[model samples]
Target: MTTVEPPSWQSLRAAEARLINTGVPGVSVGNAVFESIVTGLRESLLRLAAPQQAQALGVPPVVSRGLLERVGYIDGFPNLVGTVYSFTGSGADWNRLQEARAATDAAWYQEQQISEVALLPATCHHIYPLFEGVDLPGPAVLTAEAHCYRHEGTHELGRLRSFRMREFVRIAAPDDCIRWRDDWMEQQRAWLTSLGLETSVEPASDPFFGSAARLMKATQREQELKFELRVPVGDGLVQAVASCNYHKEHFGEPFGIRVAGEPAHSACAAFGLERIVLALIAAHGDIPADWPQHVRSVLSLDDAGVA
Candidate 1:
C-alpha cells in the first residue's frame, strides 16, 4: 500500500504565499481576492443566521482584562493571552526609554503600562458579559465577528497568531443549547460540502495550558463538549476550519447569565474565517478565477474580475 504523507508546514506556507501576503510571522494581510472571499463567507453566515433572529454584533478586537479574569481565561490559557500595553511615562521616562532602546536593552518594554483591554482571544468572550446579572426572558441567540488573537509559539499556515472568527451563540436551556449546536454542526457540514470541500467532523479539545489542562482536555473530549470540522489542506494534512462547542453553564455561571432563575447553558458555532479561505486556496489553487462555478458563486467571486 502506498501511504501519502500529510502536508508539512513549509508546503502550507508556500501555498499561502501565493494567495496572501504574510508581512509578519504568524500574521497575514489578505490580498483583494482573499478579502473578497472572506467578506462573502461572512455575509453568507449572516444570511444563514438571519432566520434564527440572532442579534448581529460587530465586536471590538480588544476586550476588558477584568472580563477575561472573571471568566477564568487567565487561569486557563495565560500563555496564549495577549495583553495590550502603552507608553504612559512622562518626558523623563520617554527619554529613558529612548536611551534604553538605543542601548538595546531587553527590558525596555517594561516601562510601558498594561492597558485595561487585551486582544480578544475568542469571539464569544465578549458576548457573555453583556448578559451579566440579567435573566433572559427566553433563549437568546447572538451572531458576531471579531478579530481574535493568541500567542502561539509556532507559526503555520492556517494556524495564525491573529485571525477572524464568526460565531453564532445561543444562551438558553440545556437541551435547547445542545440541540442548536448539533443542528448547526449539520448545517455547517452541508455548507462546506456545498463549496465542494472534502470535510469531516470529529470530537476535539482545546489546547489548554499547564499539566492540569490534560485532565481538562480529556474531560472535554469524554463529555463530547467540542467537535471540529476538518478539511484537507495539503499533502494529507487536515485542518480544523470550524468548531461547535457546548459550554453548558460555563459562561453563564461565571457571567451571572440566567434563564428562568437558573444558570443558562451556552453553546457556540464558530467559523475560522481565514482558515476557510486558506482551505479554499489549497483545494482550488491560487487563482480564484479558475475555481469551480459553485465555489465562485458561493463566495460571490463569479463577477469579482480577479485574474
Candidate 2:
C-alpha cells in the first residue's frame, strides 16, 4: 500500500508566506481569500449552534490578571501566559527610557508597570467568570470568538503565538454538559468532512507546564476529560483544530457558578480559526480559483459573502 506522507512545516510555512503575508514570526495577515475561509468556518459553527439559544458574547482579547489567577491559569500554564506591560513612568523615567531606547538597552522596557489585564489564553477562559455567584436555572450556552495568545517559542504553520478561537461553552449538570460536548463532536466532524478535510476525534490533554504537569496530563487523559478533532497539518503530524473539554467543577467551584444549588459542570467546544484555514489551504492548495467547486461554495468565496 502506498502511504501519503504529510507535508513538512517548512513547506507549509513557505506556502503560507506565498499565500499570506507573515511579517511577524508567529502572526500573519491573511489575504482576502484566506479571511473568507476563516469566516465561512466560523459561520458554519454558528449555524450548527442555531438549535440552542446560546447567548453570543464578544469578549475582550485581554482579561484581568486577577481573574486568570483565580482560575488557576497561573498555576497550570504560566509559561504560556502573556502579560501586558506599559510605560507608567514619570518625566524622569520617560527621559531615561528614551535614552535607553536610543542606546538599544532592551532591559530599559522593564521599568514599565504591568497592566491589570493579560492577553487571553482562550476564549472560554473569560466566559466562566461572568456566571460567578449565579444560580443557573438551567443550562447556559455561550458562544464567543476572541483573539488568544500563548508564549510557545516555536511558530510553525498550524501553531501560532497569537491566534483566534471560536468557542461554545455550556454550563449545566454533568450529564447535560457531557452530552452537549459529545453531540458537538459528531456535528463538528460532519461539518469538517463537508469542507473536504479528513478528521478524527481522539482523547487528548493540555500541555501543562512543569515537572508535576506530567501527572496532570495523565490524569486528564485517564479521565477522558479532553478530546480533540485532529486534521493532518503536515510532516506526518495531525494538529488539533478543535477540542471538547469537560471541566468537572474545576471552574465552577473557583468561580462560584452553581446550578440547582450545586457547583455547575462546564464544557467547551473550541475551534482554532487560523488552523482551520491553514488546513483548508493545505488540503486544497492556496489558490482559491483552482479550489474545488464545493469548497468554494461552502466558503461562499464566489460571492465574497463570508465576511
Candidate 3:
C-alpha cells in the first residue's frame, strides 16, 4: 500500500484567512478564492451536461436508513457508512444529557439515539428509489447535487469525511448504460486534462466490506464495471477524483424499476467536487490569476460574471 501523506490544506485559504485546519479533521471550510474556483468547476460541468439533456435534480443530505439498506450500502460498505443520531426525549431526558455533559464533555453524545435516516453516502443512491415501481419506455438521464458523508478510517488532504458530490445517472438498456458510462468517462478525462491536470483512467472497485469483499472486488475489476479518473495532489499520493460505474440490474432489481419490460441497467458518473478543486490548486496555485492561461480559459475563471 502507498503511504498517505497529510495534505497542504493551508493553501485552500487566502493569505489573511485562517488555515484550512479547522476543528474537524476531514471537514473543509473554503475561502472566497476557493469558492470562486469551485463555481467555475460546477459551471463547466453544467455546460458539458447541457448537451446531454440531463435533467437537474437535488437530494436531501440525510437518506432513509431503510433506503440505505435497499441500496445495499450497509452490506457493501458498512465501515464507511454513517448513521445519524438525535436526542429524542422529554425535558427530563434533556436534563440527563446536560448532567452527563457537565460531568464529561464527551459523554453527552451517549444520550442521543440513532435516527431513522443515515447520511447520504453517494449522490446517485437516491436516484434509484425515486423511480421505484415505475417503467421507462426509453432511457432517462439525471443530474443531481448532494452533500455526502462517509466514515473514513484515515483522514488526509484529498480523502474527506464530508464533501460535495455531483452525479450524472442513466437508466436504460445494458448496452446503453455501458455506452453512457464510457462516453462520460472520456469527456470527464478530457475536461480535467484541459484544466492542466495530469489524469489517468483505470479500472477500479469500491472498497467493499466483509470477508467476501476480496472476491467481490476481483470480480468487479475483471468485469470492468467501474473506472476512475485518478490524479495527484501536491503530495506524491494519487486519488480518484471521479468515477464511472455500470450497475447491471443492481438497483433495478431491488427497486422494481423497469425499462422496455425488463429490469433496467443503470450507470453513473460521480465527481468529487472538492477533490478536483484541490487538485487544481495543487497543480497551479491558490491564486487563480497565476494559473496557466488555457486552464483559466477552460474554467472561465476570468469571465466577468464568474465571480
On TM-score, the candidate that comes out on top is 3
Worst 10 residues of 3 by lDDT: 12-21
Candidate 3 clashing pairs, residues 3+ apart or interchain: none
Candidate 1 residue spans exceeding 4 A from truth: 1-22, 99-108, 303-307
Model 2 alpha-carbon miss at residue 206, Å = 0.2
Shift in Å, residue 116, candidate 2: 1.8
- Give the C-alpha lDDT of model 1: 0.82
Positional deviation of 251 in candidate 1, in angstroms?
A: 0.6
Among these predicted structures, which one has the highest lDDT?
3
Sort all candidates by lDDT, best to worst.
3, 1, 2
Error of 1 at 281 (Å): 1.1
Clashes of each: 1, 1, 0
Model-by-model lDDT, in order?
A: 0.82, 0.81, 0.83
TM-score of every candidate: 0.89, 0.89, 0.91
- Candidate 2: global Cα-lDDT? 0.81
**Model 1 CA lDDT for position 242:** 93
Candidate 1 local lDDT, residue 112? 77
- The TM-score, computed over Cα atoms with residue i paired to residue i, of candidate 3 is 0.91
Candidate 3 Cα errors over 4 Å, as ranges: 1-19, 96-106, 304-307
- Against the true structure, candidate 1 reaches a TM-score of 0.89
Give the Å error, residue 18, model 1. 5.1
